[model samples]
Target: MTALLSFWPLFRRQIGRLGLTLLLSVLTLAAGVALLWVSGWFLTAAALTTAGVSFNLFGPSSLIRGLSLVRILSRYGEKLIGHDATLRLLSTLRSWLFGRLFPRVPLAGRDLRHGDLVSRLTADVDTLDTVFLTAFGPLLTAALIGAGMAAGLFMLLPAAGPIYAATLILALIGVPALLLWLSRRIGAELVEASAALRILTLDRIDGHADLVAFGAMAESDRDFEAATRRLARARRGLGRAGTLAALAVQALAGMALIGTLWCGITALRHGEIDGPLLVGLLLAVLASFEATAMLVRSVGKFGAAATAAQRVRAIAQMRPAITDPKRPVALKQGDLAFNQVTFGFDPARPVLRELSLNLLSGERVAITGESGSGKSTLLALALRLHDPQVGSIEIGSTDIRTVSQADLHAHVALLSQNAPVFLGTLRDNLLIGRAEANDAELWSALEAARIADFVRALPDGLDAFVGEAGRTLSAGQARRLCLARVLLSPAAVLVFDEPTAGLDRETELDFLGDLAAATRGRSVILATHAQIPPGAVDKVYELADGRLSSRPSMRG
Candidate 1:
């Protein structure tokens, strides 16, 4: 519940539209109660009045017609405005989540799987759409309608008023509260089970090829079945709890009606109320309980909504691993240097210790090391994905930390080993590097990366659609396409982490041979295990034991 309240600020942004929707909802339900109340009174009065007795039928008939119209129109307006506001809120929520997600990329120290992250972004966010549309709106409207009916009864029948009010308060608050309590754990389990099922499904699909190759399809099936059973059990538990609460509410409504009827009968014997008026008030009481039934149905999902809110808030509230300086200095082009830097995921065990290196402008340098030797960590530090615990990385004279991340990133472009090719057109994938890059510039980048001929051979040329993760392209083709993207970036310093990875030996050698010409005017920091060709770089350093020992340049 506390987690759900945290989102009130975001919810308040749509308050105007939501408030109007709430008003229309009240009108719709009020008209329904009034329609029933007036109908009962009119019918009874007409039946008792003798022939030729002047009892006005026109006023009641007109009111009934007007109320029916109001109910129909208000109900329509309520749905239209309510759905619109909820959708807008969801849209804003997605954008805000993405903003929070970007700075936390690589999500260090978090065990968040890709599929689980997808579940939170999609299904969990969709669940919150019910927060206002079904839950809060219905609860508030029911309370208002219940109070109005109770007040009317108090004015007419003094004895029945307290009974109806007490019954209603119990039905509206007590039953739903009990349901939420009993189903809180069940609801949270249901959400987790559903996300687990989604994660497992996606994981299996992603690893289907390996599963088939290993003849483990049967094992995968068993795992999937277990997940489905967990989800089913959670759903059944929540449904059972809701069903019992609903029955309790029905029982309360019955008690209210019987108590009101007994009071009305006694009043009639004492000549305190007429049959028509008593019947009218009794029908109104029944109509008002309709609101409680709606409230019960919506509140059944409240526990799940609250749990979903907590899951989403957990992600949004995480402190980013890195942030921009309070007052950022503008980045300027100069030598890229890492001076006496030391960093590690765990402070007790450092990965890079007192490492220092410098690459003058337009100079290409290669750093080679075995896997897990912090070669990738070096590039990440340069990009400011994570700052070093001690010492500073500088671009010219400015400490990279003193500049905005956006500014630092704008000057340094990195192509990591696992770079992805998004689902879009070939042109669309390239445009991510430089949104305003012209066709000529894109073609030039592709040519430099040596993937231009393959792209041109396609029927759609640049417009050819690429599958998600570049599944449509071979490993080598995807690698080169990503390389083209980095090459297309306007950054002065280009950092490549295993840039020649995934390519055949022949293609790899050609890429290394042409490295100098391809990045003529920009400084290149290449981290790789590939053999560097003569003239490929001005210098090479092999990283061992968290230190760099420079090897003489192979360049002419």
Candidate 2:
């Protein structure tokens, strides 16, 4: 339950809307109780008056009609308004959560991490609906109605109100305490089991081909089945706890009904209250208990909501690996540089040690190295995907960290194997590079990347769909498309990580030539093991001995 407190800020953001929903719910409940309470008095008074001499009927009849109309109208308004407000809040919350999640996604080797994050952003975010709709909304409405009912009873019969109050407290407080206690562990377990099931399921689906090729499908199936079973078990435990809490509330209601009746009879015998009022009070108790009935079961869901809240809060609280300085420095030019930078994935083994280099504007350079050498890490550091542990990487004499992230990215854009080619149309995917770019500009960039003729020949042209991860295109085609995306950027420094990795030798050289033409007058850093042709680049550097090399070498 404590974990759910983190959502208070989010709730407060929509407090005005939520407050209206709560108001409607209370009005709906109060009107229904009032209708039944007044009807009871009207019927009893009418019967007694018919049996005796003269009795006033107009006042009771008018009140009964008015309350009945209020009950129907308020009920309709309550459901419509309450549901609208809550659904809108959930929609806004989902958008906000995705905004928080987008920049925080881990890029490299993200199998389980991706799955876990998806579960949190999707299912776990959806679970927060329970917090507003099932937990707080119902509970708050029930408390308000209960208090009003208690006060009404106290004015009618002093002793009967105390009895009703005791029962209300037992239903609202005591039963919920037990329900929460019983549900906490089971609810947490349910959340874990659910998240585990989603992750394993996603992992299998994402890696189905590999598992089948390796003859490991049976083991994955078994793991999936086991996770599903655990989730089912936890759900059943929570269901049982919910059932027990409901029964306890029903029992408390029964006690309250019996106690109210006993108090009424004793008071009538002592001439303390009249018969019409007694029947009205009895009916009021019955109708008012209905208002709190759902709340008793809703208490158990607080535990489930708390578990989900903790998971979501965990992700929301994650700090980014790179962030802008409090006071930003504006970069005045496009020259990129690395000054004595050092970094290691593990503290004991360094991948890049005192690595320093420069790429002046309009210069094209290549970094060639063996697989383990850190060519890719150098580009990643320069892109500020990861910060250097020891040195400063600067653009135009301003440290990257001392500049706004958006401003840094505006100058330095990296196109790599890691760049996402989403499931969308070619035009939609290209527009991600620059939203304001026109069709003519897009075609020009694609032509420079050497893929424009192919797209032009297609029936849909820019409207043609690029399947998931651009799987519909060949390896060379996807690379060219990604290059076109970077070409569309307003960046001055363009970094390519293994831009033409798997192409044939002739195609690789042709692609490099195309790249040279496309990147004219822009700073380019190509991190690849492939050898580049003579006139394609200004300088060639190899990653060896933990630094760049000036001399040509066939070591890699």
Going through the candidates in order, what is the number of backbone clashes in each?
0, 0
lDDT of 1 at 212: 99
Alpha-carbon runs more than 4 Å astray in model 1: 42-66, 208-227, 270-272, 423-431, 436-481, 504-514, 529-535, 549-556
Q: Estimate each model's TM-score.
A: 0.87, 0.85
- Candidate 1 structure quality by residue, lDDT tens digits, 249-270: 8898899999999999999999
lDDT of 2 by residue, 88-116 (tens): 76887687776775566543433337778
lDDT score for residue 137 of model 2: 86
Total colliding residue pairs, candidate 2? 0
Would you list the C-alpha lDDT of every candidate in the order shown? 0.90, 0.83
Error of 1 at 219 (Å): 6.3
